[model samples]
Target: MSHGWSIARRLFLAHALFILVLAAFVGTASFVDARDRGYSETADRMLAVATAIADNPLVLEASRGADPSGSLQPYALRVAADADLDFITIMDTDRTRWTHPTTSEIGKEYIGAVGPALAGEPLTEVSTGTLGPSVRAVVPVTDEQGAVRALVAVGVTTSNVTIALNARLPAVLGLALALLAAGSIATWLLGRYLRRVTLGWGPEQLAQLFVYLDSVLHSVREGLVLVDPRGELVLYNDQAARLLGIPPRSPAGAAAGGAPLLADLDLPASLGELLQSGRPARDEIHPTGSRVLVVSQQPALASAAGRGKPAAMGSVATIRDHTDLQSLGNELQGMRTLSDALRAQTHEHSNRLHVLVSLMELGRIPEALEFATRDLELSQQLTDELVTSVDEPVIGALLMGKAAQAHELGIALTVEASGSLSDSGLLVQDLVTVLGNLMDNALDAAVSGEAPRTVDLRVSSTADALVIEVADSGPGVAAEAEEDVFRPGFSTKDPGAYGRGLGLALVRQTVARLGGSLVIGRHQGAVFTVTIPTHRSPEPTPAADQAQAPRA
Candidate 1:
């Protein structure tokens, strides 16, 4: 839905209205005050002139003459003309006008109030007379004995007062318009600034964008967390809170001040360090309690314009749960190993059958029987040894499969099992990950060596623990490189291949998860030994493992 006015337009209109109203109020007040002042000043000036005319000795003597108008009227007219006054009236104590602006009004009764003047007091007021409404003043003309013998009144018309007020109106209006113009310019500039900040987006658009961002954050399966440069959490989606074991009741910005929520949750130390580092990192696998999480981190940076260095704002991290996927991959690898073993056995039997048929066709019955007996005895003996040495079917099958694979590669492989294995506290997947990787590494090294390449495998279990050791007649590991051999991504093999060095790393991880240990033995060839505790309580079966195993 759209509103007729955008936020910027609304702001501008509101500001302009406020400024206009203020200007109008100030202009009206100034005009009214100036008008009142003009009237008062005009009245005072006329009063001063009236008092001066009434005090003159010549006017006083003339006022007491047998014809007061004949002597005083001329003098009053001359004084009024010089002072720019509309009228000047000289009247007796009887209130008869002796002089007026018009000759016809001479000797007539004054048409305006003279009560104060008759009482010997000077006064100023706005009054209407024969002439018109005027601002007028009245003063008494006293005799030698201080008696009021006559009166003089001076007045200026209301039109003259209005003219004086109009003279000052332009200044007031100009000031008011100037103020309004300044306010409008300021409002326009402010509106432009707001437009830049909002990137021209209206209120409706911004609100819709917020809604979309919120939906995306909530719907994503991978956990995402954002932290500020100070190592305080800024944003955490529902998935992140659940994955990190944080309570859902925590409010936003609650962690911004101080990350009490992060402190309460069981996060790995490496992850906590990454959040605090304010640096970019990628694909770091961390183990948090029972879950394995692959986490990637990116730092937020400010614009690099002109500045020598970019400013670090914060960091964002995404976490993915890899436990289930890793389990499935291990199972698939085990199935492939079993299939390769079956293929090797089939090929071996087919070749022997071809030889036996040739011998029978040549009519060599004794030679055919001897060849068949020798092949059957050798295969049966190896099978019986493996079954007797390893009581667990999974381990027996794995050994048999690896032995056949070794034979196909023309590498002599030997298995020496000194003790029995129980399946009570052992996981077949963990066993395959450990034993399969070690044997595969040994086979690779054995095949790459000179003639007479051989690999030795040993398995023994005490009442407390199970131990396995594998050694190959290949180039031994350097003393300095032995520790780094098990580190993930550290490979001496084909450098072009990705995930080549992860086999030993996965083996080490599995060993650590099961509370076991792996070490390199001091021998002529690369010898790896793994020991796992058997007396402890069994580890819980993973949900993925409980599903159908991978088919061979």
Candidate 2:
């Protein structure tokens, strides 16, 4: 009740009750006063009338004669009645009524007699009157020579004074009741509304509701994330929601989404791999989406907090479309097959041409000589295109391999390599996969181009790194497709010449595992440089190998 009521209603009711009480007091006071004043005035008028009758010698003489004069007796009776007199009497000095309006009743002794009036002193006093003890006023009547003769007492009833309050107090009471009722009702209503509005909520419930909502937002597959390197989610978005596969509602025993789903995509292993290499991954293709997602990751890092090693507290990976890489890989693979077939045809043709020339020198000269000039010119043109375009031997070795299985194909390969590789911390199979794809890509690009065919393969090493660069002589990739090139299945070359985007991207993947960087560039032609950073490896001592060789 205290909680619900308004301050205004409380104040109003308090003031109202006070006002009612004050009004009651004033009303009672006013009524009592009016009645008293009315009664007193009537009493004074009656006393005066009685005194006048006593003072008139004719009336006094008549009354003393036992009703002798009719005029004086009638005049006194009329004056006393009109003045609302309850009683009238005359008293002598010895405290006895000398004459009374009720003559038979007034001859007894009087207790409230005005004695001075019967002596030489004239007087007035309010006292009990003759008519059954009413409020009264007394006056002394004087003789013509200013001598006190007798006293007259007049009075009216006191009952009429209290009756005045009867007519007005009920209205005042009704108004007070109405005001109090209105105040009580208003206070009660406001309080009830407040109670009703706040009844259902509690502190614990509000906290739990917010927690549940937060869980819904952060439990998504597509990296529903927000966090500094500490892994807090500040504004994990809706795409993350879809990726994480969070359900709309999370009730008990609800489906996975509702229960707050957590998908583990080998994040621990992936993060370990990332930390080992202090480089961001770009054009990274992962099978995280319905279609493969090619992601370029950027880690906006904050300074170390709380410890000597500031951990990678802030990191988010963004995703783009990666579906086209597969197609590119397939196309490159097909071109590799075509290049192989051409290599086989070229070998067969060269062998036949040599056989014809040998037969002509053995005297089958007419037919052989006719085809010899054309064959020689064809070989010369192939050599000219092969040597002029590129400048690396690893690239040339790839071309030589392609040319073995391809015909009418000009190849150009280049290399700028220094320093030697000892024991590398990788599987031969993995290295083969990486280098094989790169060279295969070179073959496809070289065969697909016009006669000015070329491929550049560069592999190098610093004190702690192994870097490989491969380039081709095809028309350079479009500027817009540069970033798109590494996405799985994204291909800019003729589909006939290359596979889907498995080659360069796979190379990049293997490089990443080794904690290395791969750079792609356009030299005289397009080039790719794969850098592998290594730790200090023990070198083979010359003396030990020489000592071992002594047995041989």
Candidate 3:
């Protein structure tokens, strides 16, 4: 908003002023040189005319005769007219004029210097005489014995010299004008180029914009990255460096020359590929190392007010950490799974009570009692088995809740857990995250599959490692999509389905964080296996198997 004089306009004005001053200086110097040369030429010509007249034999004879002006006056007039001289004077050494351009002054004392001529030296100077200021020359005539006899003075007036200098003025002025025009044109072209590059912004405006942008990049909560059209990493802020697990750049590294290339960055495959493709993405989720990030990208462009349409400058991407958010979402999902299971159980218990009350009223107490006993035994068996198996109560509760949920949905879920996982050298939250997501995926798969829907879960902790496997009776992942299943935002379900692809991505991230490996294989259904190395050794225990019967 701080509008100021544009660089183009400023440069144009400055250069134009410079050209004007230069032209004035050059023109003045040229005019002065021409005037001086004109005066010098005039003086030289006057000196030649004066010396020629003094050397004339007719002049000597006329001057020596009784009547000097009788012949000299006509002769002086003829020579002055022929030589373009302003005036001619014939005088004696006593400063008495014999002949003159003005005939009235004839035989009068000369109005100008005659001593130099009497001394027998030819003298040339600019002097004010009866005819006005002129470049004049005076020379003396000598006899055969070298005694001075007479004098001749010849000059061209200052007016005539000025006229001659003016005659050459057009050429000098024309050359100066041509140089000034050339300079102006060149300045205009340079100004135009500067305008295009700077987008007509002044230096101060550009500097202010840069300062604001730099502050935003550093102060904003989200990570920001800028890539050039050639896939080079042109800029990245501190948050971006931290999220991407790269070294932070120095302050001076904000410059393009100091920034690293995209290929040189140790980025996750999905993110690296996305940046390299220069594709626009909105709120995309990606997993890198132990962290999950939500990223958005768009193509950057330069203004189109120049020579052509807007051009692709590069791409700008923003990143926000999603790891904590994903963890919280997983916890909420676990709670929802437990809530659904409780609701189903409550519904079943209420139905059973209604049946019992109806039977009692109909006097069929034995059948009601038998049904109740069988239901209690089945529920009690599952609870006892899980309690004996999973040492971590949180994990046990999660598995139990999932089993109950599956039973209500008419899917048989079997869980086999062995060896104490309490000493598995993994955080309880991490363990729950890994197992909960896998079970959720399994249950969802089984519930949507063909008749006799079933899911199998196996968890075992050894002296060196902990392993978990979940197999579901559903359509397995496609061979082509096997690698993509773990990528964020990839799903076998409808693309528009809410929260479709994030579950498996979180599972993969957790497993990797625990330094585990997950393998996908097919038997009657899809089987997912995870193995995480551990340094702790736990006491061996008999395997416990708990199975939930499908609802009848």
Candidate 4:
């Protein structure tokens, strides 16, 4: 047979260990009990006969003197004859046999389980021999004065004990076999009962389990996915579907095999490597669309029984929507910037007010009036910018924030965006993604250049497309970085970096999805132009469910 993997081997070993432990316990207990019972029964009978002889007052008194020639010989003969026994012996306290039916045995020392009996208490035990285990007993003898004097002892060889034990041998063996059989049967019955309790429920439990699972799946705000060991998806949630732009329901189940519903979602290459290696991979899938998805993965631990064996294996993936989170973060930054601006303005205003009071006191009203007029002009400019925004709230707020940032950075921003886009067919959010990345890149390029840097921006729309163009006066694109500029994974920074930086690539993807085109070249500086068809709206996307085949 071929060697198996950890998971399969583990299952087999688990079952084997359980049986081994149970059998060992039962066998040990049985051996101990049978050994104890057999020894005790033999010993009990011998000790009783020995004690009866010790209890004889005549024998106790005679054993104390221990002169077998006069009293012991007669007593030993009388007892043996009366009990209808073969052998009998009486001893002094030192365990020397004083009376033996065989004259040679008299006055001989017999060592055995006789110490306690010689010390004035009756006792019994057994010792093993070449033939088998034997039983022996000792009983104390007392003098006429009631003082303990000697002991009475009796025993039989294993051969004799066996003749007596053979009568019960059938019953003993039968009981032992019954016990073993009962133990094995009991273990199996218990195992069956446990299985019934845990796995025998009908469809009611199955439905409830499914409902419970569904509730758990939906409760998780993050998209959760469970794949079989074969790397096929078995479970996926609503959030995962929505973030991937998958249909509400496909005729097939979630994560169906056919042309993956959101196949266009750029899965990281590292994830593929992880799957092959039985590891896990994760990264943020940033699509320049409505949302950013946080993809996470965890590899399933192989079942120990399948050690080094072919077995089912898979991983779990979670996708969380970070779009709202990004919006909240942006709002918080805006608030912080607003706070800083208010603090600075308030401090400056306080100083100016103090100066104005001093000037009025000094009758210098003209200088104070000039200061007030300048402040008024600045306020009016801010108000005009707010009213003449490029588009919706999210866009207008972002642009205003960027403008404030530029002013803080001492960088001049020449905003020349045209056309009323609030009513345009293009998603304002998608436009923001395209514009935001380009604007940020331009700003970064401008920062390292000479002082008083400027970024030229123009946004316009034609009858069939929405166009966005950005030109910066910084040093033109580096020759080396240009070729890989729009490549999917070719980033300007380190390869292992957390920032995927598919800004240009994301721009390309979003444009293509919207049935549009993009061009990049120099326009006296760095230039980027993107065009997307300006349809009224996209057609309602259909569900993408399809039947799936069983995993290999």
Candidate 5:
């Protein structure tokens, strides 16, 4: 439970202990086995010595004579010395000794089992005699008739067997030490690697950190993404995938070693380029498809243990959906524009009333009436045109407001719309986004252009698609910049201009979301034509609807 020792240290110590225990077991077993083998080999050697002495002719000849000790005793002592045996004895069938290494024991009864030896089968065993505990063998000597004549016994002491076993201890010990040394070295190397990777964190600490990170990744409302230095998407939560229009994490993406690369994903050019640059950005707004996002990114840094400075790892980005906020902001701007238009109309009406009052005072009532009638007719006609042309109320109101604003700015705004936009199969918000952005850009372009500043807007709905075009009598876009004009942060205006690029981008994004196309043309000025499919190119199926539904 203590955090003092890291995971690597604990594992290394465990392995070292295991190796030590194993070596001890092996060495002990080897020593025991050697001891056993030594005793058995000593018994075998004693047996062979006894058999050879028993078959000796000199011993056989002396066995029949009255003075057998004369030939046997000297020969037994010589054999014992030559064979390095503790003792050798020549005895009679009745268990009486004829010769012994201890000359005093001649003619004495042997102190061991001799019944089987007397019956002619040789026997080997461990027994205690005058020379102490020893492994001994006994054999019977036979004459010409194959009858038992005399017996020969030989033995080597247990102490000498132990000494032989001790001789092999060095080799067993050496092998065990070699095994332990090799194992320790390997464990040390593995520990060092683990320490570097884990940064010396214990198992419990790592587990807690993992749990915390997983919880934060899933719980946060904002989309979080991590990309490696190689531009491989290292990690992304469900929100990130959803916001980025990517497939949810599947088994393929979850594979430990198969993270998807950034280049493989269909990301917005602006977003992709930003991520690839690995530059830190704060609260940069970008549009992807129909959604507006506020993105912030920072360089991810990691420090090695004992290293002074952190190294650049990759990048971490957080994305928040700004579509709702952007929509609200646009709505506010439209309201402000209407308010401004209303204020201008009120001020002009007050001025006209003052003129009428002055004319009445001067008795010029008919001229005043004619002037008021002309102004009313002009406003009424424009209102009637907007009401009859645009079917959607929100879009109609938006155009009316934009037209009013354009008029106040000395820009002639003309609207030519026919047929109902009810069947456009596009959301009113999408239509508003597209039309509003185009109108605003057209107004700006016209106001900044030559003498006859004019903006023309045309809207129509057909069986297959709905078409909307806005043309400004301003400097048209250059041919080389046609493709990049709709990209976020691209503008033909001053480089230091702020909030001047996103209008076109939003227009393009809304069009794309509705399965629409936008075309740029030059007809006396910049022309923006948007075409949206009326009935959604391929209608959504019940299965697709179900798939898109949120789970409980």
Candidate 6:
């Protein structure tokens, strides 16, 4: 088994190692340069001293004498001692030494390169001679006519160069050590900063977190979009792209100057406005293409520990596909209405039965028979009227069921029909959604009002469109709020009601989906008018009838 270091430790270690290597390289170069400079300075001083000796008139005159060494020996020795030179040799142009540091080496041929000197050139170099390795310079001694008279050589031994280099080593090493320490400190500080930025998570932990967050964002059904405070898109999940009907990835040039703009996504105008507003919004239903999305938005906020105000960072929005849910809810509501109608019918039948029994007990057999016969005839008449007037079974059953409910609620419900409907393109579900919500709203409004409450429903069909108008005897919608009534979650009824406002919105959506138009009439009470286009077909089948039948 092997254990790995944390990210902070690994980063610190790598930085420290790099600094160490760099410091070593710099230190090595500095040391080599210092040694070379020391040697060069020593060689230049030797060359200058040798040139001065060669330029002396007395030395030049003596070098041309019968015994040059006899005159040059003392002068060379004194100069060598005073100038701290390891060796100084004066020689004739034949490369024969006239003076040397050791007397035994005098009069011997020079054991180093003297070719440049013989050609009357002055030069400096490090070379091995009778005195081990030394930095030496050779200068050609010239007479008054500039003719070469002799060669003068001076040098500092390798041992002296070593001493000089050693003198500067401590300071160079100290500087290198200081740099290493500073680098270590910097590396440690950088590591600490990175740790804080990462919230103390290592690379493995961060990777895991990223994978988990990505999975959750993609797996969830709701669409999620995050935008910066400047109305630029920051992050969005796959669901968002799917919901908006956009490509899975941002398009080329979608981001302006490396920051994505929300407007580039081509969202619905209402949704774009909401996202740009950066305000908290809840349950704002907006239509996009053929889908209806319920969007909720919240601002991302952050605050310092001692700060009095929170800073607005950005906004996050969740989009839910509510089209299917709303349709199913509309169907469920229709079933509930049918159930209420059946209950009312049952109550009415029980009341009639009690009346018949009471009449029989009173010993008025003829009156009892007449009463029973009259009640049965009236019920049959209403059924006949509904069956004869409305040809569409779904609409007919819905109206009959709503009439029964209204009767129980003490609201007079009236249904008037003028034409028949074909089942070709007329969806029963859509009709139920439209008519059920309208009648339910009308009944609720009329029954809650003063006496003589009434709801009038008029149905008429043309060769191209079906018209429905529902009017209720209640306080009409306020002028200012009429336009807002169709907006989701907008209701003038009880504020605590959760689902009261969605009915009218759903009705409007269904009408629009069928390429129909809904208008609110400026009448004594609230009047809603809807017109839906239709297509003709053959008579309804048994299956169609059964599908359209009310649950009761």
What is the RMSD, in Å, between candidate 4 and the native fold over all Cα? Answer: 21.0
Q: Number of clashes in every candidate structure?
A: 0, 52, 0, 25, 0, 0
Q: Pick the winner on lDDT between candidates 5 and 6.
A: 5
Enumerate residue pairs that collide in model 1: none
For model 2, give the 10-residue run with minimal summed lDDT: 255-264
Give per-residue lDDT, candidate 1, residue 485: 79
| Cα lDDT listed for each candidate | 0.81, 0.55, 0.86, 0.63, 0.86, 0.83
Model 3: per-residue Cα lDDT over 457-536, one tens digit each:
89999888899999999887778888888878887677556467877888888888778899999977789999999778
Once fitted onto the true fold, the runs of candidate 2 whose alpha carbons sit more than 4 angstroms away are: 1-350, 353-400, 403-408, 414-422, 446-451, 493-499, 540-552
lDDT of 5 at 355: 90
* Tens-digit lDDT string for candidate 1 (317-380): 9988876876676667667777887899888889999999999999999999999999999999
Model 4, 56-109: lDDT tens per residue? 777755654536447867877786677644456677766577766678766667
What is residue 311's positional error in candidate 6, in angstroms? 9.2
Evaluate candidate 6 by giving its C-alpha RMSD to the native, one decimal. Answer: 6.3
Global local distance difference test of model 2: 0.55
lDDT of 4: 0.63
Per-model TM-score on C-alpha atoms = 0.65, 0.34, 0.74, 0.47, 0.82, 0.81
lDDT (Cα, tens digit) per residue for candidate 5, span 217-309 = 888999998888999888888899999988767433455667888899888888998887779998777898768988999999877686879
Error of 4 at 309 (Å): 10
| lDDT tens per residue, model 6, 69-159 | 8988998889888988899999978878999989998888988888888888899999999989999999998877888989999998999
lDDT of 5 at 165: 78
Question: Could you tell me the lDDT of residue 136 within candidate 6?
Answer: 95
Instruction: Report the number of backbone clashes for model 6.
Output: 0
**Runs with alpha carbons beyond 4 Å of true place in candidate 3:** 1-15, 36-83, 87-131, 135-155, 175-220, 224-263, 272-279, 299-316, 355-374, 447-452, 535-552
Model 3: lDDT to the true structure: 0.86
Residue pairs with colliding backbones in model 5 are none
- What candidate 6 gets wrong by more than 4 Å, as runs, is 1-4, 77-84, 102-104, 144-147, 163-186, 213-240, 249-261, 266-322, 494-497, 533-552
